[model samples]
Target chain A: MDNVDLLISRFLGGKSSAAEREDVLKWINKCPENRKSFFLTKEIWEASSICSSEIISEETKQWQTLAWRIDGLLQKEKIIRRRILVKQFFRIASIVLIALITGWSGHSLYLRIKSKTTNVGYEMVIASKGQVKEIFLADGTHVWLNSDSQLKFPTEFTSKNREITLEGEAYFEVKKNEKSPFIVTTRTHKVKVLGTKFNICEYPEDKIIETTLSEGKVKVLAGDKIVDLLPGMQSRINTETLDVRVGQADLDVHTAWIDGRYEFRDKPLEKILSIVERWYDVKVVYPAEMKQMCFSGVIKRHKPVNHLLDVISALQPIEYSISDSEIILKKIR
Target chain B: MLDENELVRRISDSDHEAFKELFLRYYRPLALYARKFVLPESAGDLVQECFFQFWLNRKSFIVHTSLKAYLFAMLRHRCYHELKKKAALQHYENDTLQRLRYEEWRYFETEESIFYFDLIEKTKKSFDKLPPKCREVFDLSRQRGLSNKDIAENLQISQKMVEKQITKALKIFRNELSDFLPLLIFCVSQLLLVVIRKVFF
Candidate 1:
């Protein structure tokens, strides 16, 4: 109610003068608690703008179109790989006779196969679509991966670093080794640690990459820039630009998947549905009008798909029905 | 990081991680750059095409320059070709589109946008947690865009009471923050609010 509080409110409402805005900014960033509160207040004020239905649909449509294109190429890559192998099989038979006629040529053919097999040295653990799986490395480090995820690791840890590559999302309880650090390599960034607990969500399909360190210290290296994350902080790396954001980690929200529980604090109805699709392995057909309807709640990952749908319907003004692997969500009239 | 040349070389050998690593590294910036020249909607499509080409040609692909430079050159041609096909070649000279001015454009183009996007989602959640009177006052000022005096008059309360209720709402949001960030960057905290306000509001 005091003048400073009035200034803060005015600044939040876009009515504050330049000097007053500076004062509010300084006060808000003076500590974490202030930043936290400013975050909440801004959210409340920005709600209506956030609910813009057109922008949400357009953005997702962009992703869907690009994703379908990628899927087309990925499937094509699969067939092409097989075709190459078949052609090579025929060539190898003819190659053997030619190689015998020329000793050096035989040695070269052997080297080519050796190189190809060596390329396959990297082992991949794929959690098929709609699957979550856990793996423990030889070093006692534990990793739990989310659905439709892939972890590519070497058969044995190299002398320099223990490195593993992640495609979708995973949580790690790394074994401490001061001499040899554990490194997680994603498509865009690398997380390095001597030993630590953290969760990483860097789906190639998603434009953003998130890293939340639960305990100890981990260094997040993106490009030439290296960011060190302490326990309880998350680094959000943008795939398109140079901006990397460091903010308070919601440990419960980020780590909830470890217990098969998914928590959405306040997510759009459509956003939740996409997650539901990944969580329940179902295709969601929802009315476009309800895209702006936002909800917040916790849903266990293993519960029946309808159980979640039922709970959501009871809480919010939306109706849903499921058949086979498809679920349709309609606005309640 | 291994120099991008090494990454691209490894990608040529069909290393999915390396390809992805390269994709994650360059995709955002390339998308942003192409967006400057091409129609906004076509930017992402063009970049994806570039990546698809990069993947298909990996076996024979060899880059003599930095991978960053390589990607930029590849996308530059794609955007040019796209415009030519549309017969909007004059768009290439678009004074507004030529220089990206990404410092301001980043809020819309970068991954950091998610932070603000999320604040909107969490805003409702946090607002719902405020005390009843405080939430009511916040809705009036924010959703209804009423002045503090107007809100006070409509609610039949003192202006000071309205101020107090709004302050109470902010306090609730602050307490709800998940403590991932240690709040050490004094500057980001300040610039963040300014930027989020400019962006979402």
Candidate 2:
């Protein structure tokens, strides 16, 4: 390489021995044009350095902040999605479990009743440990008796219509017969059906009468007033006013007793306790103020009453006692 | 030299630690050099992107040359592309302004009426008259502080050729301004003569 090329290489490498550095300075001094070129190069280099440093630092900071914000948003979305999935899974699982249990219990109950039958004319009696006797009518109709309840019906209906009488809550599935209507007579009211499924809830201690229709149609008569119910419809008769009001019926809540699943939907705490008392064959007592609380949800009717009480106590402050065939509930404080 | 070759081999094998070591070794100086060519904010990014390109094309990299030379060459090429882009943008802006003026006024003329305007315009015109390659060599040496060897390496020419080009450019500049030099010298000599005459006449 020539002298200029060697000098250029040293400068480009940014390396120079003390003697070589002096030689480059002397060369620059020998020519005015060379001096001007060197000064211009230095100025341009300095300007570029200043400009790039400021811009690079600003861009890096902005990019980091953007990345952090994106990470935070993604994390929040993941948490929300996880919570929704967990809740949805639990809700669906509970419904499925309830259906399976109810089906199994109903099948077992049907088998037990079938085994006890002797012949066509003989009475087929089914009695629980502390509950009243029940019987199934010949035309695929069912009747349930509450504790201390007694129901009597012929094993076969030979005449124009099928009829039965009940002392307490009894659910019925009346055989479809347009020509021969089915009738269920209670202490205060009579229910007439034309091939419909319904529940009649009447107790001596409870003055109000409730009848819910699950399918087809039923006519409820109290005094002179008559109420006709379609599928998924209910009627409540107030004994004091002698008035009847019809509204939407929930089969799960109204007919759960026959399936061994007692369900409540925003019912008053007093009413929930009353149903529990009859199903578990127990007595419940609570302060007047505590009766205002509402209860909702379903529990297996065969489960120990204490288990159900524990669920309630977890949600609110309450206490309970079990004595042989009775259960009592009261506010904790 | 053996260690450098080994590091390059490891880097080609996708070893991140070796690559990181290489990056740390060259980042500061390359960034400083790039700062002389681009805006301060973009200098670090330019340096990082050059390293990224190096890794991306590692499979194709010829390991015969020192990795340092190859990296510097890549940076230099990127700087040239950046300058070309900036020049195009400037040209586009100037063209837009000129078009806008013509549309509004219907007549646009190049003004030549500023102080020392003729001399500066003449100097620019003469500078533009040089051969393209000669001008490039001169500019890189003068404006970029690149030595002849760096210019030869960057431009793919012999070091002797870069030195000859710079010498030719200096001779042309001296010739172009020779007339002004004589006048300047005569004025300085007259000033010196008067000062001496006043001191010892």
Q: Each prediction's Cα lDDT score? A: 0.72, 0.63
Candidate 2 per-residue lDDT, tens place, B1-201, comes to 238888888877766667667775566555655554566556566667677777667657777566766776676667657656665667734444322322211111111111112323344455566689877886676546576678999999997788677656544654564453333333223233223223222
The residue ranges of model 1 lying beyond 4 angstroms of the native Cα positions read A1-120, B1-201
Shift of residue A73 alpha carbon in model 2, Å: 99
**Quality of model 2 by C-alpha lDDT:** 0.63
For model 2, the TM-score of its B chain against the native B chain is: 0.44
Residue A154, model 1: Cα distance from true site in angstroms: 0.6
DockQ of all predictions against the true structure, Cα-based: 0.09, 0.03
**Which candidate comes out best when scored by TM-score?**
1
lDDT of 1 by residue, B23-140 (tens): 6555555554555456657877787778778877888988775566667667766876775665454453343333222222332322333333344455546666778888788777
Q: Is the docking of candidate 2 incorrect, acceptable, medium or high quality?
A: incorrect
Interface RMSD, all candidates in order, equals 8.2, 15.0
